[model samples]
Target: MMTTPIPKTMHAWRKHRGNMEAVWEEIPVPSAPPTGFLVKLIASGVCRSDHNLLTNEKQPSWFQQQFTLGHEGCGTIIEVGDCVPSNCGFKIGDVIALLSVPGCGQDDCPECSRDLPQLCQTGYHSGIGQDGFYAPYATIDVRGAVKVPQGVTPSQAAVATDAVTTAYHAIHRRGEIKENETVFLFGLGGLGFNALQLIRAIGARVIVSDIKQENMDEAKKLGVPEQDLVPVGRSVRKFVEEKGLVGKIDTVADFAGTQETFEDAQYIVRQAGKMLCVGTLNHKNTVHMKIGIRKRLSIIFSYGGQTQDLAKALELIQQGVLNPQVEDGKLYDFPAVLKALEAGNIKGRIALLQG
Candidate 1:
């Protein structure tokens, strides 16, 4: 393949409105921010959340129309702006994770000061309010860029920004699973799989359930005991009985956020046990308040991963504590990316490398 010169216009997948198909078009390359840089995207992961936005099912007013779509991008710095430090760490060739979350530029903004702009109401998210890296070139504010460890490929680090790190936050921060506690996971998709590994590393007894046996088998290979993986429709009582957790388990992490999974989470944990809702269940799903009140359980709704969590997840991958083995359909390039995402055949995170 021959490398082409940097052009004023490049190819990108774009959508004009919520609930519309994304079309590839020749769009102008974004410019570097005064305190930011323009990065040439190497690869960007297609998450299920992106699918939702693409479909416009949960489209917010800010992302009204015509925006580039992608957040989990990794690449090298190409053009740095005036405020960016020449020695602020990144160089022309350094591989870095795109923060994707834009701050309000207000020093007093609570979310910005805490380095967690993901929660800022005034802050804009890439692929949402601003143009994301669905193109070869994208603009990113410098505050959230993190250097990737040596030897990690762009595909491997693509999920570092969201899927993997989101699990890191849900497990380590929200669930707060102790070394001795038993942790049950509902759904074994991208987030649940990483949660499974993180729980295992914490020395917590981990049990996972999913509709797909493939994910279960994958979990088993990650050192989760065969007995720990369960089928989706099976009764929670069976899992509790088989694990001998009559009253031993302390937590259940529900990543599916379906009504059935939420109810199962309630039944699986012991009295006063905690259940963290880490999944993006945006649809009409409901849990009986009576059951929750009766169990006296702690239900925590966890959203995106914290900024610091990404670094920890990257470290775990580097140290061999976590492994993300993605398949071909889950890692397609730009030409095929939209088709795969539109068909909804993606098993996990779908990645698109810049052409």
Candidate 2:
């Protein structure tokens, strides 16, 4: 059990000016969070999705000017509120993964009715639609916490909470790709690389693409063949004709959701092929209607994963099948990490550790 006394105040990265920025601020330590527990965060991920939330001109109408920023987190519970019963399975000092989305775990909510509480419309969306774990200490609903099995480090658990879970949702839950089918993966950066491994684990052949050469090189090191890596800037139609895989690519998973990425991938997917979209930025709904109608192409968009998806991701993590490469030199200071993230200077998915 944790023996350390809780601090009365902690440092946090708060969104100050309603723009693509957050500044470090001294905040009151949270306590007595209803149905949730106060946690001491070990680490959190600085994701492109976090960047997407920061860049959007329109902040959620209810967002506080000084709210904490972060969705991917791994923490140890320091104080469990009364609402979190012993049978709820969480307690003080237990390590847990934070669910990026909010959920009340109530039976009547639409997302809960469907057993998809990650899309919980009525509760905290930790770090995205609500106060997240950018702070050293934060509060989270007990239902939103996923137990980190023994042997997972805080950094790895932090990444797994969102990156691996989201990728699992994209590949296994949403894409439903079959064995031996050819899958085209766009954007092998942060989340794409994780999706690449999950797809391989399912026995599907993967064709990788990315806007960054560094990421392609990383995927190559992960066993993606040099020839199978398509440059996203190239015309998809031309690549299809040249590669002679026209109508053979079964699915196109777009982790890069720019207009260019979507438009280019639209042409690469086979007739009746599925295009699974998981990116949070640059979402252009410019579908090619006539062509899509004729081809019977299926397009699916997935947000964060459900609780079951987290379980599946954790299972993979336990089996040592899903460790995405972390960029060198972990950042302990939140402000410096935010600066690097805003510049898009960080090469891959990054972890932010407590100072």
Candidate 3:
């Protein structure tokens, strides 16, 4: 039932061992897996993690030496695998958003059995350590693909796979932020901005801090009060103390992951407050033992989101509750986009549209 002819080879952005720069090279087109589909990518999102994959020397043992580098993608199914269930409702020409880390959902699998598939170590992590959707076409397992709804643009659907969904998972699930709680949020980058919107949707009072004044300004436009924004170059600890919020913040969502932010979070949150960490700007961070023990604070870390989280995130976007501030770029702009993201030049998320 194949109609349109797929090319035998296509160009992709990839990382090679020892090379800090991503290489644009041609590779053979992949065939659909028995339980997956062959998709022609319409849009893909550039993540800060993409930069880490290219430059970081130390990586997980599962990371491939060389692999295509894009995890967030939206595409159309060009071919369907024979093993894909008819009841799954996926079909050729269906547009779908992909989950980068769709874990092996075996009954005996530890993470999947616990409903934590995002942490599944047995499955291939696309774009993180495996060939992912930076090419014209990529194959995805049925467990990782969700059909994109009507009226959702490919760009919105693409970034929702990770950028929006990850924030949703962190704020709604891991942080367990309630409407009446006061949250001190650090960072306003791609994921941080989305977190702000989600926090607003929950009707929580959020105090935002970022190194960039533009981001803080953008937060104001998003309905965050002027007083809640920590001024650029102002010490977060001092700001909290001045505002009489020391030991008053109900939760600290540290999406900045800087040493300063970490230290500030420890000092500012109330006794027994929750610390939800999602960023990794500095992988290794120090915790004050006395401060932690005295306050009895709960430190929580979140990673990727589940398929259900992605679906809910998409629903929020469709309903206009979550407005992901994404800028559009072309697929070939991968290198420049990563450079800008690393330099903190890009505001909000950027989705690269496929030609």
Each model's RMSD to truth, in Å? 3.1, 2.5, 1.9
Per-residue accuracy of model 3 over 324-350 as CA lDDT, tens digit each:
878899889899999998888877778
Put down candidate 2 lDDT per residue, 160-197, tens digits, no spaces.
87888889988998899889899988887678888999
For residue 72, what is the lDDT in candidate 2? Answer: 83
Model 2 off-target regions past 4 Å? 17-21, 51-57, 231-234, 327-332
Q: Candidate 1, 193: how far from true, in Å?
A: 0.8
**Whole-model Cα lDDT per candidate?**
0.75, 0.78, 0.91
The ten-residue window of minimal lDDT in model 1 covers 326-335
Q: TM-scores for all candidates?
A: 0.89, 0.90, 0.94
Select the stronger candidate by TM-score from 2 and 3. 3
lDDT of 1 by residue, 54-110 (tens): 665554566646888888878887878888877888766678887676466578998
What would the TM-score be for candidate 1 when compared with the true structure? 0.89
Top-down lDDT ranking: 3, 2, 1
For all candidates, what are the clash counts?
A: 2, 0, 0
Residue 147, model 2: lDDT of 90
